[model samples]
Target: MLVLILGGITFSHAQTKSDSLAIRQAALDYIESQHQPDSAQMARCLHPRLVKRTFWKYPRQQREYLRESHADEMVLLAASYNIKGDKFPPNPRKEVILLDVSSNTASVKLYADEWIDYMHLVKLNNEWKIVNVLWQFKDANRHQ
Candidate 1:
């Protein structure tokens, strides 16, 4: 009985760790797709109903502003921008930290080259997909 209980606990812990890794990978894919402009990979990371909100200060503006974007727009912009020229750094500073995961829902923080994104994800159809993102520029002076 002791051995059986110990084995069950270990299996449960392993499953949780696996889920955490998967959630982290999803967040990484989302950031990488934008940096490299891979539309297919971006689509794989995001859900169709994704809602991304960005907060930034405009040039010479005192107050910050908010902008919203959908998954389709993100993919379209990734394909349109920086395709011909090399805009991103050779080794951009990217980081993904898993904040929390509960059953089918998870949250992660991604520090991309220029901004920090707090992402919300959901497990759907046996896959993890980013559903929402709240982002801001790393430097308060820089604006989009």
Candidate 2:
């Protein structure tokens, strides 16, 4: 019985590690897909119902407004956001920090050159997909 318990623990640890790695990969894919402007790659990691939200203050606007981007819009943006290849720095910031993971859900924080995104992912059909994100520019005055 003790041996069996230990084996179960070992298996659980391995599974957790695997999940963490997959989750990190999904987050990285989201970031790199944008930088690389690979819409297909971006579509692969995002769920069909993905929702990305941000709070933005338009120029000369007194209040902040909520902005949203869906999966289709994101994929389209990815295809053109960096078409010229000069949008980001030579070595732009792309940091993915795994916040938490469970059996089928995970949360991550991705730091990019211009903004930071808090992302939520879900495991579906044995694949991790980004389902939600809340992002903001690092510098409040900078507008996207």
Find the candidate with the highest TM-score and give its number.
Answer: 2
Which tens-of-lDDT digit does each residue in 25-127 have in candidate 1?
8888787776777888888889999999987666666677888999999888777566864767888777888887777888899998778899999989879
TM-score of each: 0.80, 0.86
Write one digit per residue (lDDT tens) for candidate 2, span 33-76.
87889999899999999999998776665677889999999999
Error of 1 at 55 (Å): 2.1
What residue runs in model 2 are displaced by over 4 Å at the alpha carbon?
1-15
Taking all chains together, the TM-score of candidate 2 against the true structure is 0.86
Q: What C-alpha lDDT does candidate 1 achieve relative to the native structure?
A: 0.82
Off by over 4 Å in 1: 1-15, 57-63
